[model samples]
Structure formats: C-alpha cells, structure tokens
Target: MSGDRLTAEVVFDTSVVEDPGDAVLAGVARVLAGAAPAWADRMVAWSPEPRERREIDALATLPDVVRGRTRWATQDRHTGNVELRGATAELNVVVSVNSSPLARVGGRLLLSNGITLTGLREQVAGEPRTDWMRAVFGEICAATRPVWGALYSASEYRAKVMADGPVLRALGRDFSRHLPGLFAGNYFGAPYVGLIGERVFERIGAPAARKAADGWFVDVLHDPFAWRDDDSVTRNADLLAELGPECFFRKGAAEGRVTRAPDW
Candidate 1:
C-alpha cells in the first residue's frame, strides 16, 4: 500500500497565481481546464519563474492557449513550473505551483498556498482508480477554490487530521507534515474529504456537508473502500471532532485566520 504508485494529489491552498499580466489566466487557467482536456492536449513542460524575465528561448510563447495544439506553454505574465503529457501513463500531470503561494497577508497564523497534482496514479497497483478521482476531484475543487483542501492518502491523511497527537506546530507554509498550518492552536485545518471553501469556518463537521458547483463538498466516502475500513476510519474521525471549537482552531478556538473563507 506504500509503493506501486497511487497518488491522487489535488491539493490547494490559494493565491490564485498566473501574474505576468493577468486577464485570462483567471485562477490557473481553471486548473488547466479542470485537469481533463488531457491537460491541454499535451505539451507545456514549464519551470521558468524565479522571476523569469524572458529570453529562456522567449519562454516558448503560447500565451494561454491550453486546449489543443499549443505545444510549449506558459505565456507567463506570471508563475510557471507546469508539465503535462497524457496519451498514456495516466495523463502525466505535475503542476507544482507557488510563485509566491502566500507568504503573508494580514494573517494571525494559518499560512500556506501550495498547488499540487501528480499524474493521478497511473494505475497504482490493484484497485487504483480510487473512485474515479471523485469526479476529477470535484472539478479541481471547482477550479482552484481552496482555502483548505484534501483528497487524502499517505496514512489516510494522518488518520484524517488527528492533529499530530497534540504535536502540531507548523506556523507557516509547510504544506504537509500531516497538515497543521496553525489557525490558532488546535489547527484542525479541515479536509477529511476535500474542498470546503466558502466561509471555511462557520462550522461544518460533515453530515455529508453539501453544496458544490463552486465550493463545499465534504462527502465522506460512500465508497473509495471506506478508507480501508477501520469502522470507516473511525467514523471519519468522529466527523472531524464534530467541527466545534468555532469550526476548529482548538483550545477555546476562534482567534484569527481563515475567517470563514477569506481568499480570492
């Protein structure tokens, strides 16, 4: 269960990148057209920003075409490091973003802004499809709308955010050491299922949550083998501690950060 490849990464943290000029890149080109137009019909292979300033062969010059017939990629008005290839091997995706994935911006704690999604497990051993990636990760969380996100794995997202057994201490962009970028103290950092944007706090510990076509969808496993059944992963970790403590920040909670769903 460890090796043999089975990664369905669809992570998100938000900063809405793509900045060499903006306009039509509108939130990561809708996550490369929601990750399925065979990721823009193959050919983009980027890696140019650290503040890339032209002349890397003029950065190939496709300026946001995306769909078919656009060989190179990233017309860069900002952010690069893309890569796509699909005809086989599970549409080889690798869009590691972070051209400034939120360093700081009026925060109390909770800071992180990654964006990852590696090739969707090219048939990772037996039973790989993992429920057909929950409708392409709910359309990549309705096109990059994630203040918090998850599809889970690597020990079922650390027993579904058990919060490092009272060891949580992330403070800033760590991505995942089992997630806990600190929203105050008890950093529950929501994601027992995935995609829970809009006002991410106002309490939603799951009752099959609801609403999606844009945001919110914590539908905890009716399938996906019930997370290998340990009584359905301990009832989805008691529905993520019934999302109390003012929608999770622990220790009397509610002090700062993620005031429900603050991003753009």
Candidate 2:
C-alpha cells in the first residue's frame, strides 16, 4: 500500500546544566540526534516492546523514508550553566503535513504536548483500528510522554496549562452558568478538542459547549489544526514567552526551517 505523503520539521531542545558533565551532555546530544528517527520508528512500530526491532532498525535501513519524508535538525548544544531566553522549558517537535493520517494524529500529539500520560494513554486506547498507523500513533504517544513529562516535571513548567489556562478557566465558569445545545455539536460527533471539550460540556451544559465549540474553532483557525510548514513556531514562541526562561533546559541557536508538501 502507498503510504500517506507527509513532511515535518522537528526541533529538539536538550537540557542545559551548570558545569555540564560529559555523560549528561553526551546523553542529551544522543537524544537530540536520535529523537526524530526514534520517534518515527516508534510511531510506525507502535509497540513498546520493540515488536521485532524492525522499526528501530528501519531508521538505518529505510533511508528514503527517513531522509525524504522526514527531516531532522537541531540547535547547537550549549555547555555550562547558560541562562535560556524563553518562557517554557521544552523539547519541541513540530510536524507539518499536507494530507495524511499522520497529520490528524500529529494534531492530537501537538495539542497534548506529549506531557499528559493519561491523555496519551486514552488517545492510544481510543484510536480506531488502522493497523500500522494505529501502532505508529501508539508508539509516538508512548515514547514521547515520558520524555515530555520529565522535561516539564523537572523544570516545573506547564506550557499547555499556562498557555491555555485562562481560556479553559473562563470556559469552565461559562459552562457552570449556561447550557447551550451548540456545545454538544462536534466535528462529525468526534471529540475535536478531546476530553477537555467533553468535560466542559458536562459541567457547564449547552452554553459551555457552544463556548467550547467557539474556542475550538477559533483555536483551529488561529492555529489551523491542519499542517503548515513552521506553522507552530509562532504558537510555540508565544507559549514559550508565557512559560519563562527557567522552564527551558536549552535554547536553539537558530530558528527552524519549513517546507510545503508537494501537490501530488
């Protein structure tokens, strides 16, 4: 079967330390270098047990897919106790796609930020049967959760919570007061905004759902749930600005590059 055509720009931010040790920095370096392919492999493999180790091995064996459809780049790893110039402490991975199941799945990943283990697990469990893609989604969700959790937990940073908190809180209040029918409407009855939307509707009623729909629509338009090259940079930067410098473990020396997917 022909694979879905997708292109993504991935960024990795390793942790910086005071008097960075060889082991730590080296490990971080390895993570930075290996994250994308590892993520891709896991996504494809979907099994935490390494099914056949085929996915991991595919990183080396499948050069065309790894190099052409996927592009991996990183910033210079800084040594010593260097103060970062950002709000959130994060290892950012941005994937841009035109038309692919990967895009839809990736949107969920981006929204979750790979931090909420429960959320990720829920997503993996809820996924529709799609053979390889389901496995890929599960693998990506499983592998990244721990990495993201470590980064956020260690630094005490909450990017999504901080960035979207006010909106969520206000929505919460709105839901408690009003019950609107529009709130129950969803994109094809599927949870576009995930459990958050459902919870809002449950607590507030219809009005809350309407507001949530509005919020979700606005979010999709402003951020556009669909893939675009470097589409996430502005949003990520905005989140970083809100989170502050200490949240970040390391800073990239350069901005990421994005390319449009070719029309088939």
Candidate 3:
C-alpha cells in the first residue's frame, strides 16, 4: 500500500543579546546528536546549513517589538566580543520526512539573510520497497522539539499569556483581523512550514494527512494570534462517530457501553 509523506517547516527568530552563531550551532549539534528520543524513529535526513555574513547583519538590525520583550546576552564562542551585546538571530531550518520509501525528503538551513548552507536539500524521487521512512520522520520531530521549545521559552509573556484560554481567544480574534498582512510573504518563502505541510500531505493518505496539515496550520495561526486551545480535537471526535466506536478508539466496544432502547 502507498502511504503519505509528512513535511513540516519551522522558522525560529532567535532574539540574540550576544553573538548567536555558536549558540545556534551548539543547539543544532545537540539535536542532531540524539538529545531528543522522540525523533529517533522519525528522521529521514537532516543537516545544518552555513550562515551568510549578510544574514547576520540583517538580524542585528531588527527593531524591538516591545520594551523588555527582547533579551541580550554575550557568548565568547561564536562571536569574539568581550562584552555583552543586544542582538537577535533568525535561523531558518527545514525538515522533510518521507512516510514511504518512495517519498522524498527535502530540507534547507539558512543563517542571516543568505543561503549559508547549500546542498542540504534532498529528494528521494521514486517509490521504494521498505517501510522504514516512518521512523525517520519521528526522529526529525524529536530532534527539532528542543529548538522550538527553546524559542517559545525565550518569551515568558508569550508562554504565560498563550497558556490562558481567555487571553488566547482575545489574541486569536485580534490576529484573525490581521491574518492577511501577517501571513503575506510567509506563504512562499524559504524555511516556511506551509510548504512542508503541503508536501507531507500529498504523499500520505487524506485522513491522517489532513489532520497533520490542519494541526500545523492551527499552530502557526495561533502563534501570532496567541490562541492555544486546539478545537480540532472535538471536530475529530465528531468525524470518528461515523466510523463507529471500535474503529474510532481502535478498541472493540465493551458489553456495558452499548445502549439497547427499543422503539416498540
């Protein structure tokens, strides 16, 4: 049977107070080195791209969105500065996982504003005989978790505010109002997750593929809107009803759960 391939693109805007190259490289190395077990079976292929000097300069110029929103620190490893500096880093990384041996994996990593790392993107082309691709996907997911987690953790306000339902709802409403402008260039650019989602769903079957796609979409939308609760869970439950309890939960119905009311 043919299976679907899953793709995800996650962009990280690192708020750097100090030189960011070494920290970014160290984090990437840790992920690739098996720091997250959730990724062990899922990663098909992954790599770190070189940083362009210009990109670093662009990152250094970003305006602070809010007072006290950005943090700066110093590192002696990546940059040769002796004193701490207020800087932010933008790292673009792509991860592709083939669900089927026949599926393809394409990835790219960029630093500063240029394509620092070249030749990292790959493609598998035609179908294969084995089913080992699933594990590869899992590994990629596991490896990237730390990076994402770190980014989210950087902003205590984002973390605290997003965790609350009322705040998330209000933020979602506000974000939806500006969705067009917020997502304009985001749709087709390098290191965008939407492209990854599209590729992954194309290879996988519709049901699971749609679920994954929608999940990622919702997550991204939420990031700007700050909406945290995932309503997809309820929607999924409703859809599963037609498939019956056995298939829905992947467990056969028990004797006590069935109702036997007659219309006599």
**Which prediction has the highest lDDT against the true structure?**
1
lDDT of residue 51 for candidate 3: 20
Candidate 1 lDDT, tens digit per residue, 1-264? 433332344444443344334322344445444445443444444343332222211112333432112222555323334454433355444444444454433543333333444435534112245544555555555554454555544454443344565786333323322233121111122342233334443355344565554445665555443476777656555555554322333322345544233232
lDDT rank order:
1, 3, 2
Of the pair 1 and 3, which is ahead by lDDT? 1
lDDT of 3 by residue, 107-198 (tens): 21211111111111122212121112222222333433211111121122233223354544212111111111111001212222342334
How would the candidate models be sorted by TM-score, starting from the highest?
A: 1, 3, 2
Worst 10 residues of 1 by lDDT: 181-190
Question: Number of clashes in every candidate structure?
Answer: 5, 14, 27
Model 3 lDDT on a 0 to 1 scale: 0.24
In candidate 1, list every pair of residues with a backbone clash. 19-77, 20-77, 20-78, 199-260, 200-260
Candidate 3 off by > 4 Å: 15-21, 35-264
Full-model lDDT, candidate 1:
0.41
lDDT of 2 by residue, 1-264 (tens): 112121111111222121234222233233333533333333231212222212323323222222223222342222111111111112222221121211223222221111111111111223421222223322332322211111111111222222243453211111111111111011211222232344433443342123322222111112112222265445444433332322232222233322112111
Instruction: Give the Cα lDDT of each candidate.
Output: 0.41, 0.23, 0.24
